[model samples]
Target: MILTSVLPELILLSADFGLIGSPRWRPLAYQYGAFWAGLLHGWQPNFAVQPVTMFLTHAFLHTGPMHLIGNMLALGVLGQMILERHNTGQFILIYIAAALGGGTTYGLLSHSAVPMVGASGAIFGLAGAQLVWRWQDQPKGDLSHLRRLAELCGGMLGLVVINLLMWWLQDGQLAWQTHLGGTLMGVAAAGLLPAQRPILLKIRS
Candidate 1:
């Protein structure tokens, strides 16, 4: 069950390995798979559904081993946590929504002609969904709940700081727009999608 739940992550890792082994494959994959904002603006040549497909495909590609490992690790942890509370289908939906949301935001906001790759946006989405679930599980209509809310806020602030540091380290190459979009979509998906079991009910029981 655990392996099956992480099938997507495994597939992504495998794809990354394949790309790494065949140096030539990386360029081809980036050309066809990575999300290019120019494709949306019609500045680049249309390639038969590439604009739409790139939204999800880009999440499967990574810039390097470290990038792939970082995203997969986060996905593995967050995916398992979500699976514990939701079904496989819900988890998949959230992931896809996040990828699409991230791509859309990047396309709309970023002016870079360079193709964007990596699953960080989807990882952030999972984090967002987890945050929502955690918040919802807290005791409401009470003073104690405020503490939990503060903690959540602190976590968000930490994420922002991390993003800023990464952006600076990467020389402003970090696609933060994607992260913002994915997070918003993940939070929305958590509320909109039905859980496999009510978290609070499970906790109380």
Candidate 2:
């Protein structure tokens, strides 16, 4: 069941690996459709599919091996944790919403012609949802809530610092806009769910 949640990333990894070393496959990927700024701007070539579909499809594409590896790792770890607490349906909702949120942000802000690819945005969404869920689960009217909230924020802070460091190290190759968009959507979506009202809730004792 857990593996199904990350099936998209796994399928993407397989596709990326197959494309490697094949000069023909590179052109094929673009021909089929990959997300780019022009999709929303109405400048995308005739070969590309509808822009709306690309928003979700783009999440299944990656630039290279390392790119796929990092995202898959984050997805596996965070995804498993989230699944343990929330139902699969909620997890899927957050993932799709995060991807679209990221794509929309990138489409609106980026000027680059190159297609933005990877699952970083969705992964960050998982991280954000995880943080917010922990915060929301805290007991009410107690100092313990404050402490748990702080702990959640501290953990998120570490992720932010890591992202910033990676930005510097990669010479700004990361799409931080996507990360921001996904996070906002994830946190908001998670918070909107009714507290302790579902049978799927798996609160750890």
**Which candidate leads the pack in TM-score?**
1
* Reference-based lDDT, residue 168, model 2: 100
Model 1: pairs clashing at backbone N, Cα or C within 3 Å: none
Which ranges in model 1 have alpha carbons more than 4 Å from their true place? 1-22, 141-149, 198-205
lDDT of 2 by residue, 1-205 (tens): 2343345445545555674345456445554545777767767555545677767766776766677777888898998877777777888888988988988888878877777777778888888888887766555544376687787889779778978998999898878878877887788888886554322334455
State TM-scores per candidate: 0.82, 0.79
lDDT accuracy of residue 78 in candidate 2: 90
Q: Backbone clashes in each candidate structure, one number apiece?
A: 0, 0
Model 2: lDDT equals 0.73
* Residue lDDT tens for model 1, 1-205: 2233244344545655784345455677788888999887766654888988999888887776677667777888999889999988888989989988988888889979999998888878888888888777766654366677896787677778978998999999899999988987888898897656646633332
- CA lDDT of each candidate? 0.79, 0.73
> What lDDT score goes with residue 78 in model 1?
92
Candidate 1's clash total is 0
